[model samples]
Target: MKNWLLHILVNAIAIIIVSFVFSSVEIEGFIGALIAALILSILNAIVRPILVILTLPITVLTLGLFLLVVNAITLAMTDALLGSTFEIAGFGMTIIAALVISLLNLVLNSFIKD
Candidate 1:
């Protein structure tokens, strides 16, 4: 339970960092970031696995580069679900933000365990 809250907080921080780095990724405020983080985490868990599995052939063909696209799609899905609060402008920016968010979450989570 503690770990889960930490994960959400880390995600919110990652979202803020990504928003600062990328002009296209706009997080409205702290609450918006929280909502976006939760939505993104849920989408990643529920949708990313299915996408990874369904695109296994292409993922293999691309030597795993396609996973980045999968990640971007999840971020985009979060944006779509959240409406104007979390606006991820384009696919390019979405992809960039997703990559940065993933890295931030990984590094932050590593040191932020329960």
Candidate 2:
């Protein structure tokens, strides 16, 4: 429970930071941001592995560059599901947002020691 709550908090911060960094992405408010983060986490956990496997060939062919596209797609899907709460405008913006969010998640998780 504590870990889950920490995850939510970290995601909320990531969303806020990403939205601030990119004009194309927007997080409406705290609750909306939380919901978007939760949805994104679920999508990343469940769907991302299958996507990675199916796209392995392309991923290897591109020397791992295809991972950016995968991340953008995941962000776009989260935006679509969360409606206006999370709005990722285009592929470029999605990629930028994803990079920022992933970095933020890494930094937050690093401090948790678990």
Candidate 3:
């Protein structure tokens, strides 16, 4: 449970950083980032797997690169859920934001022990 909370904090930080890096990605504030992070984590857990399974063929065909699109989809979903608080300019920007967030999470998560 503590680890999960830590992950959420990490994700929130990532989201905040991404917002700063990309003008197209907008996060209202720390609280908004936290909420977006929680929504993203939930969507990744609940919706991502289903999407992965459903898109296995394409995922395999693209040598797993299609997973990035799946990631973007979740980001878009999060943006939709949060409305104005978390806004992504467009699908293209969302894909780039997703990649940035994934890389940020990878780096951030590495500092913590699971």
Return the top candidate by lDDT: 3
Worst 10 residues of 3 by lDDT: 19-28
> What are the lDDT figures for the candidates, one per model?
0.91, 0.86, 0.97
Candidate 2 backbone clash number = 0
What's the count of clashing pairs in each model shown? Answer: 0, 0, 0
Candidate 1 residue runs with Cα over 4 Å from true position:
none
Candidate 3 Cα outliers beyond 4 Å, as residue runs: none
Judging by TM-score against the true structure, name the best candidate: 3
Ranking by TM-score: 3, 1, 2
Q: Candidate 1: how many backbone clashes? A: 0
Q: Which parts of model 2 are misplaced by more than 4 Å? A: none
In model 1, the worst 10-residue window by lDDT is 105-114
TM-score per prediction, in order, is: 0.95, 0.91, 0.98
Model 3 lDDT, full chain set? 0.97
**Tens-digit lDDT string for candidate 1 (1-105):** 777777998999999988888888898999999999988888988999999999999999999999999999999999999999999888998999989999998
lDDT of 2: 0.86
